[model samples]
Target chain A: MCDSCGCNITPGNRHLVAEGEPGHQAIDVLQHLLSANDHAAAHNREHFDRHGVLAYNLMSSPGAGKTALLEATLQALAGEFRIAVIEGDLETENDAERIRRHGVPAIQISTGSACHLDAHMVHHALHDLDLDAIDLLFIENVGNLVCPASFDLGQHRNLTLLSVPEGDDKPAKYPVMFRAADAVVFTKTDLLPVFDDFSIERATRYLRELASAAPVLNASVRSAQGLAAWLDWLRDDMRALRARIAGGEAVRPAVQPDGAALHAAESAA
Target chain B: MHELSVCQALVEQVVRVAREHGAGSVARVTIGVGALSGTEPALLRQAYPIACAGTPAEGSTLEINERPIRVRCALCGAETDARANRLLCGACGDWHTQLLSGDELLLEQVELAKLAEAI
Candidate 1:
């Protein structure tokens, strides 16, 4: 106890020796550290909804065929629905350039050293495109399986790709990323015949271990085996989103529950 | 790896709070770090000082409360604590589980310094 005003002394605030005597005030902030990003994400989501755009956040390790899959998806859907892409990388417009070649609007977010694309970056890119002109929007996050999964980015669905060469154990090793996925895709599946080490069954088992019931689809831009399923899935989501919007409601993806509370859509609603 | 940026945001919030309360300096800040939050606590701890440099919270202490993962079973409607990697419900071994409260990067409280009391 202090000789003067008896301020409660505890191990946590012991270092505040000067203030331990009295006049110490503790404020309950009760705020999420990711609140800013989440608010931006919610705003971005609203933009997508207002324009009736279906957004997807695509994440994976480097060279995991995100751009390649986007190229293939664009080729498949460009004729039916107007598409746009926001490509994220440490530093490069290469992915955006590739998407633009498909005659679709593509905005590039160069994060410099950031490992993931946050909502603010996506919001900035969102302004560059005519949201009404877009039917489907893909945000290709920086090639990272770890951090990208943690951010919302206002996507209606989160897709994490695990290529065949990357091995089936990826779902086991990165449980958080796989767990956050609305759907996990096995990219570069054409090489499965060559690589004996990769097994779709084992990968599915590992994903199930995380208690994730996310659909795991196979895809190969080169061979186009699962290409139809991918397109069909997009169409299904578009139809679902339309239904939700018609009922005066919006759709939210399965956000990692803890961080979900911080998003503006829920908080303000 | 994003811990540094996380810490930076944390410090910014703390400093903002201190300024808002007209505090001369900040004494301590507490945060909850969850297992599934995708942020490494050790890395966050190491990055705190760097983030707080030259701010009102310069010499403040950061208390990290490591939270455990908990999941709610869709089948059984039970909420149970589980490991980070394995999120199955403890009540029943069901594959359908909804995470209740594991991934939390939350700023809980901030202690601000005031005038010393007269002894």
Candidate 2:
């Protein structure tokens, strides 16, 4: 039977079957599925630079304490850095509410069924938040280590978290996320003594293998251990972003009386 | 889980490719699913149809080529296919094995057909 017309067709005209019709020609296409997401992410990066906001995309598995780390970060850096958050979740605005309680502006982007937050969604959330007023922007990506690694959220840096309870083999199991991350945070260190699953040496070795130069920070948000170091790293990042802005290395928004800067000024007033 | 999200990306890529080549519809998309890529082929298959809905590649078939995880043992000069759940080299009981393949998630090729011309 012919693939095209379901008739008993010979092999000589099988090209037609492959083509589907007489005029129909088959074209070979080789492309990456993440191309669109990558393009959008680049645009988002430009948007962040224009507003002088240094964005960080945070990724981790559920119960990796990403929210807790953010909470502690918000508390520690509130006075020093003008921070804002865009929280992504499968459901609920709970994470956003938590961040908002810290007095920092936050917007919840509920993906509903989506596993990861792509660049387009982040772009929309940026409009709602006063980007100019924000020195640092943290995008708490949906708590899935696997899918989020494939999609770039247009952030300047990507941070992946792994908790002690999740075991030390995560870096080896989920290499893509570890390889893509600018930094890896080992969260829930306070529980390390209780759990035989986590191994610092093994995890560190695996992380180094996947991401050679990526910094790994071990922290326990519950105990406030290593929180200062995390904040210090953030401060350094913000300082570098500010320097880039001041040196005209970054794209600055056009000075209109009605743009983001004006909006931020008005809000401050 | 996350495989569903990846399937969505795959569908979008197929549709975009079909449109670019003036293809009426996509027939098949050949993707390379690596063993250590952490994507489940079954879950991806389940998600493909839902993701392709309302897209140009709606009825296209997803052909996944599962790439075996190949690793080189550090202790011994032997390369072997590593198991998905276990990283140990079959040739030698060595934990220090460098991965050679099976981490890629690529849409290697897309087959599309143009519409028939009106007689």
Candidate 3:
């Protein structure tokens, strides 16, 4: 065990020896390695608080229509909210540009070889956008369901999207993502009939089992099916968020999005 | 897949800790990699060297302690180890279970090299 010291000490013995040595010592950290990223995320959350921005981290597999849903939601809620986006991808500013076309400011963070977007990257991207002017900030996370679940970007909520084409077993297959989700959106609902094997009831059941309190909403941008519910969720969430800020709460409460958006939609009509 | 970035973060923490303690170099870094941490130990081991290159942690030994996934079943009130990702209750065969452990990705300790003593 001791190739360097050549002493009759095991690796564990070396640890003890190192700790007892004059200058050499074994530091017992017992800390999460991602604490640095978590710290950065905390700072980002503080910034969002001062700006009254209700941030959402959108996570899903590739081609799950995250960008398309964002586009549709932006159009539907045009003048109601000041929305901005931070699009993350391994390559390309294409998603960011698409968001910009909807008249919302967006910043694309291209994480060269990184599969997930860390808090450090979001911290930099926050500086690039005018946070104070944004009512809502959408962090479209790397279009990835796995690695993104582990990294906290300090968003007010985490929403995991599962499209009908991706199958109903996604919640079970990728439990971490579902468990980490504040809410799960079933996107591309219009394609449900086409994909006979994809069951909304089954998906919702799994989502309920994993993320007990998280809402499982269905939306199809193509048919504008659940877009209203999606947009209302945003508006009502922002309203409650504004209320919290007005009341001097630094952080959002554990209040789930319980159809407040739907109530707002009804009142507007 | 993101083990490279995870290792990068690990290196940053190690370097910071090393500097704080006024250590010259890192001898060994011990960490816990849980079964459900979504990181591959092999990938992390491979990336550790690359992440450490050009830093004080260069050539430092990265010792990973694999932690098993532990779950607490609600039905049978039993705590059991969950092999793979089944997450079912071992005692009652129920899926109504909550995770108690195995998502941890922690840096347990760091062995710092001492400065050379005067003859």
Candidate 4:
């Protein structure tokens, strides 16, 4: 019996010590808690690449018109390219059902008590879709500005929408979310006339203050011109992604560095 | 809050590490939470107990090492601290700065509880 801490060391245990102070073993485990999610996200990304699909993660606060934008997009590019959706929400299948009504395959991920969708949830959603038939997939994330930005959903591009009603100060307040955006959209611009408090200039300046060069585009569900600009951006982005993929490269959205920044030794670089 | 979920992941990771080291229990779990991590440390501390309940890490202490937001300038190559909202190079005041750190949620270390004696 080992007299120090008493029990049976037996001289063979891996925690064996010849003659030293009995203490807790502190292991240097420099790992990210989000590694599992990042791995699952990488798997999903590879799956998307295999099927030549370009995925976009649409993020915003509640009532930011993510689904409305998708509906308009579906209407605009119905026959041109095959499209699908993965709608994530705390509850209800309303968004998925809405997308389904457009004759497109839409999968719903009901996270229940969870605030945001993780890669595993999106992985399950991908199982239901025919990726080969889809050229573009939009993962409309749960309506929260904070949590979703920290999670990666295996998308080629991350698009965050800030409605005019949400005010221009959002970018300054939610820096993490704004910084994760590859592109930001000013949604519900048609309401800007009534919501005179919202300023495009101020909002843009706030976004630029974060040192983010993410292109801000104007979009309103009511106007054709607004939708046209968004559709053009989408088409151009898809073309860029396709070109990259053709050149044996894949587009990587600027994921929140909480996990990726650690695993890839991005800090060391 | 999402910190609860993040804590869940943290517990999962700690338990896994504990098992890897043949640890029956854990005494402490240390992590680095960055200013720009989008996770609130207070919320994580609140969620820790719930996440550690019934796990090997139950009753363990969660030591949070808060990392400050830092950016490196392309012009001057100086790494300095910056505010969460403002990511400009603190030294050169350059807007063309890249994030050097501060978004990390790293599980830095873990202290395993009384090993062979406890067993």
Cα RMSD (Å) per model? 3.6, 9.1, 7.4, 6.2
DockQ each candidate and list the results.
0.58, 0.24, 0.44, 0.49
Model 2, residue pairs in steric clash: none
DockQ sort, best first: 1, 4, 3, 2
TM-score of model 3 (CA atoms): 0.84
- Give the per-residue lDDT of model 2 (tens digit) for A141-230: 999877776666677778889999999989888776776677789999999889977888889877655523577888999898888888
User: Which segments of candidate 4 are over 4 A away from where they belong?
Assistant: A1-21, A264-269, B114-119
Fnat of the models, one by one?
Answer: 0.70, 0.37, 0.52, 0.75
Best-to-worst order by lDDT is: 4, 1, 3, 2
Q: Write one digit per residue (lDDT tens) for candidate 4, span B2-86.
A: 8988898899999998888888888878788897889999999999999999999999988788887888888899988888888
Tens-digit per-residue lDDT, A155-191, candidate 4? 8899999999999899999999998999999999999
Total residue pair clashes for candidate 1: 0
Docking class of 2: acceptable
- How well does model 3 score by local distance difference test? 0.79
Clash totals in order: 0, 0, 0, 0
Model 3 CA lDDT for position A19 = 67
Ranking by TM-score: 1, 4, 3, 2
Listed in order, each prediction's TM-score against the native is 0.91, 0.75, 0.84, 0.91
- What is the RMSD, in Å, between candidate 3 and the native fold over all Cα? 7.4
Query: What's model 4's lDDT at A22?
Result: 54
Query: Which structure among the candidates has the greatest lDDT?
Result: 4
Model 3, A22-106: lDDT tens per residue? 6556888876767777667767888998777889889999999999999998888789788999999999989989999988999
